[model samples]
Target: MSTASRIAIVTGGSRGIGRAVASRLAAAGQDVAVVYASNDKEADAAVGEIEAAGARGIALQADVADEAAVTAAFDTVERRLGPVDVVINAAGVMALQPTRELDLAELDRQLRTNVRGTFVMAKEAARRIRPGGAIVAFSTSITRLRFPTFGAYAATKGAVEALVPILAKELGGRDVTVNAVAPGPTATELFFDGKTQQDIDRIAAMNPMNRLGTPQDIAEVVAFLAGPGRWVNGQVVFANGGAA
Candidate 1:
């Protein structure tokens, strides 16, 4: 089917990489549903931008970890837009601390949002996504870097990565593709939080490109997978500028 007839739901679409992905899909002529957890205004603004791009857009609020909320969000998309053709699980949190010093509550929160939330969305998508649809889950290059204080966060993403191939296999003859995108150090608020200028520069210098990845850069990869990159499935594509 043409992109103009497709529908996409992007979790965490209010800001950051998720917003970029939603915008890119809209630009590609797909209807987009921008799913946010708490920010109504930002979600509305995102929908405005999508509409400005000349595509149908709607903002739905749902915590990614909440299965009922996610199901309702999908139902809204199907009713207003169409049956979902793409689902991008981009809503997540990062709490960086040494594993030895990390609070169990923090660990639980990360797992809930990153792992359980991804599973919930993936499960829903598996059931509802149209044939020839695609599911993109987010991971992190930190899983490869094995960086300190990233233990818990990486663990959650690692679980997401593990789900990709297995889910693709389960989908079997459905012709739906499941994959993960592991971004390296990116210039997003989530990556910049609690980091010093020195730390930022150091990370930016780690890649051969000598710069952090942009949300658009990562979004382009997603757009490819969602549209024409069907043969590439059940794999983790690192959009990290050779940082890993």
Candidate 2:
């Protein structure tokens, strides 16, 4: 299929890495559906940006973990924009808490949004995305960093990493590609929240690039996977400036 007519769904597309990915895909000539859990204004703004990029765009709202909601979102995308050619599972939550003092409720919340959310979206994409499509899921480099307060967050992402290869195998006969993009320390709200500037600087220095990754950096990788990088399948691409 040609890029101009292709369709893509980006979960959590209202802000951060998801928004960047959605915009990048649209600019690459794909009609885009910008999905968000809340914040209709942000979602709408993202769609506007997509349209301004000369591609069709729409905004849909659904909690990533809600299977029914996500299914409906995909249905809406098909009805309005055509069959999905790419699905980016970028909806997730992150909280830093030491394992010993981790709150059970927090853990459950993270699992529901990160782990279960990826599963639900991937399942839906597997069913609906056309052949030659791609499914890009988000993961974190923290899984390898073994950061002190990142145990819970890293665990959820590890589950996501585990799912990528298995899902690729499950879709063996299909031309679709399944992969995960594991970004190291991107300068997104999720990464900035509850972090001191000192902490951020220290982490930035750890990367050979001596800077935190921008949303655009990660978006470029997603654009590649969603469009021309068909040869790359069933693997995790780390966009972390060689931090790992």
Candidate 3:
């Protein structure tokens, strides 16, 4: 997965899959801007890893759902790293509860980061990404699994999936790619927050590999899309190890 050096901006790059994506991209010779909502210490450490991989790295703070903040983050990336070639909206939130008892406030929170965040990032990427650039958004395989308690979270990613192809077509002449990576039961803080050991084991066994996905596993798919997988545009890639 070799690619010419390019500039990439990864939201939520301070941790989990986004952090892996940032390090992976940098290792592949891309200058990376790690956009995190907060947690400057973790963000700085992520940049340290990127720089350790021999690529220029910086950390920026912004609320993904805030249009002005997103715009400013992009401006900073452009000023510090040059025009962005890859924009990955991996900033997301999850709240798992049955629809009957779902928390409306939690739903709102998920909507803000997952749906609105992607919306803002996609709009910015469409406007600012260079020719031949790529935009990647996070989705979840829970939509296909139809699991209980994932209603609100899946709904937001569903919105992400819906938005991707439409944006791809809207950017038809620009040579930029817009796609979503829908991961299944990944082993991240976001995924493990509520699950018990038994819950995790059962879910892991459902997949053929009998395991949960690693953030790095998802990052590999994203790295491909961000780098040389230009032909695979406007699709939701299910990187779930056949869980669904």
Each candidate structure's TM-score, on Cα atoms with residue i matched to residue i, is 0.98, 0.98, 0.98
Candidate 1 on 75-95: residue-level lDDT in tens?
999999889999999999998
Candidate 3 regions exceeding 4 Å error are none
Model 1, which residues run further than 4 Å from truth? none
lDDT of 3 by residue, 170-201 (tens): 99999999999999989999888977899999
lDDT of 3: 0.93
C-alpha lDDT score of every prediction, in listed order: 0.93, 0.93, 0.93
- Residues 1-244, candidate 2, lDDT per residue (tens digit)? 3566899999989999999999999899999999898898999999999999999999998998999999899989989989899999999998888899999999999999999999999999999989999999999999888889899999999999999999999999899999999999999998999989999999999889999999999999999999999899999998999996
What candidate 2 gets wrong by more than 4 Å, as runs, is none
